[model samples]
Every structure is written in C-alpha cells, then in structure tokens.
Target: MLRYTLMRLGIFAGCLVVVWGAVYSGIFPRGFGASNGLWVLLLALVLSAPISWVVLRKERDRASVQIVTKVDRMKANLDANRSQEDVADDSARTQGQPS
Candidate 1:
C-alpha cells in the first residue's frame, strides 16, 4: 500500500512538472493572477489521475487484495475472541449457581 501510494505521488509530481512547463512557456493558458498556482495543481491532478489509473492498475489491485486479507484476518480473530469470552462467561455463571 505504501509503495502504491508513493508511485501515485510520483506520477502526480511528474504531471505537475509537465503542466507547470506548459503554463510557463505560454503553450497552456494560466488562470487569473492569484489563481495560477491552483490552476496548475488542478490540471496536474486531472492529468495524473488517468496516467496513474493506467500505470498503477497492478499495484492498486495488489494493495486492494492486501487490505481485504488484512480485514478478513482481523474479523476472524475478533470472532474467535468473542467465542472464547462467551465460554468463559458461561463457566463463571455456572460456578456461581446453586447445586
């Protein structure tokens, strides 16, 4: 997951550089005055999204599988713990009852 996130960040940074270059060289129009930086960031995000989607499909899928496996393991552990606790509680209740 960390690896996938870093790869996505790298793609976004690359797109940001390309977008900045285009705007700087006047090939791409900049936003009004103070909004120029926001414009570049937004364009970078838009461009990076598709590039990352195409480039990172495998990594994304692997991360997703990892997450699902982790969640399943946690759920199994929780169910086991609950069952153990219930058994302990039942034993304690029976021990306290009259003969």
Candidate 2:
C-alpha cells in the first residue's frame, strides 16, 4: 500500500512539473493573478489522476490483494482462537470443574 501511495505521489509530482512548464511556456493559460499556483496544482491533479490510474493498475491490484489476504488471515486466527476456547469450556464442563 505504501509503495502504491508513493508511486501515485510520484506521478502527481511529474504531472505538476509538466503543467508548470506548459504554463510558463504559454502553451497553457495561467490562472487569474492570485490563483495561478492553485490553478497549476489542480490541473496537475486532474492530469495525474488518469495517468496514475492507468499506470498503477497492477500496483493497486497487488495492494488490494495483500489487504484481502491479511484480513482473511486475521479471520482465520480469530476462528481458531474461538474454537480453542470452546474446547476448553467443554472439557471443564465434562470434568465437573467450577465455572
């Protein structure tokens, strides 16, 4: 997950640089005086989103699978613990042990 996050951030940073260059070269229009930086950032985000989505599909899927596997493992552990507790209780009852 962290790897995927960092990769996405790298894509965004790359897009920011490209957009910054375009704006400076007059290929893209700059924002109204006070909003120029914000404009560039937003444009970079918009451009980066699709780029990251397409580029990072495999990484995203791998991260998702890791998460799912971890969750399943945790669930299995919980089930195993519950079964052990049940066996302990049953043994105590059969032996007439106190509660």
Candidate 3:
C-alpha cells in the first residue's frame, strides 16, 4: 500500500513538472488578455487531486457495501444449513424411538 501511494504521488508530481516545463519552455502562451492558457492548465491540475479523491472514496464505499452484503448472504446460508441439519437430526431421533 505504501508503495502504491508513493507511485501515485510520483506520477502526479511528474505531471506537474511536465506541465510547468512546458510553460517555462514557452509552449504555453498568453491568451484571453486576462490570465492565459497557463492559468487554465494550472486550474485543471489543481482540480485533479480533489476529483480523484472523491472518485476513490465513492468506489471504496461501494466495495465496502458489496462486501457486507456478500457476508450477510453467506451467514444466512449457514443458518439455513444448520436448521436443515437440526430438522434431519430430530426426524432420525423420532424414527429410532421404541414404538
């Protein structure tokens, strides 16, 4: 988990480096007379972190819910199996009784 986290952070930092490099290299130029195309790129970069976080959170929640549902189903099946066994045992005991 730590390795995965570090890798993800590294990739995010690499993207920022590449973007800034492009701007510094004059690949991104001024536009609408106000902020510039660089401003738009920066905004997109800033937005990525929050968006990724929200998406991950939602997926984790969904996975947790699915896991809980599966566990409940398994428990219910076990209970039913136990009940069936009990019924079979009762029937056998009655059959073996002296008339």
Candidate 4:
C-alpha cells in the first residue's frame, strides 16, 4: 500500500513539474500576468490519471487483490466467532432446563 501510494504521488508530482515548466517557459500561452495556479494543478491531475493507469497497472492490481483477501479473511473470522457464540448460548440454555 505504501509503495503504491508513493508511486502515485511521484507520478502526480512529475506531471505537476512538467506542466509548471511549460507554463513558465511560455510553451502554454498565458494572456494574464501569471498563470492560474488551480488550472495548472487541475491539468496536471488530468494528465496524470491516464499515465498512472497505464504505468501502475501491476501495482494497482496487487493492491486490489490484497484488499479482497483481507475482506474475505475478516468475513471468515466473523462467521467463526458468530458460530462459537451460538454454540455457547445453546449450551447455556440447555443446562438451565430441567433434565
């Protein structure tokens, strides 16, 4: 998870730097005195999504599988715990009844 997150962050930062460089270098026309900061960030995010999707496919799949496995394990543990509780309850009720 940490590795995946860091990789994503690195991609976003790279996109941001490239976009900023374009705006600073006048590659992207800036009619106003300074380029809009929010617009630049938004463009970077938009550009990063497809790039990340392609570059991080393996890491994304690994993270997804890990999530599914954890969920399945949790469900199994919960079912087991519920069954034990039900058995204990049944035993206690049977003991209280007259033989």
Query: Which pairs in model 4 have colliding backbones?
Result: none
Question: Model 1 over residues 42-91: C-alpha lDDT tens digits?
Answer: 99999999999999999999999999999999999999999999999999
Cα-based TM-score, every candidate = 0.97, 0.82, 0.48, 0.91
The lDDT for every candidate, in the order shown, is 0.99, 0.97, 0.68, 0.90
Put the candidates in lDDT order, highest first.
1, 2, 4, 3
| RMSD in Å for all candidates | 0.6, 2.4, 10.1, 1.8
User: Could you tell me the lDDT of residue 28 within candidate 1?
Assistant: 93
In candidate 3, position 42 carries an lDDT of 73
What does candidate 4's lDDT look like per residue over 1-99, in tens digits? 788999999999999999889977988754344547876788889999999999999999999999999999999999999999999999999999998
Off by over 4 Å in 3: 1-55
lDDT of 3 by residue, 1-99 (tens): 344455446556665666666666877654466666557467446755675565456555666787799999999999999999999999999999999
- Top TM-score: which candidate number? 1
Per-residue CA lDDT of model 2 for 1-99, tens digit only, reads: 999999999999999999999998999999998999999999999999999999999999999999999999999999999999999999988899655
Cα-lDDT of candidate 1 = 0.99
Cα shift from native, residue 39, model 1 (Å):
0.5
Return the top candidate by lDDT. Answer: 1
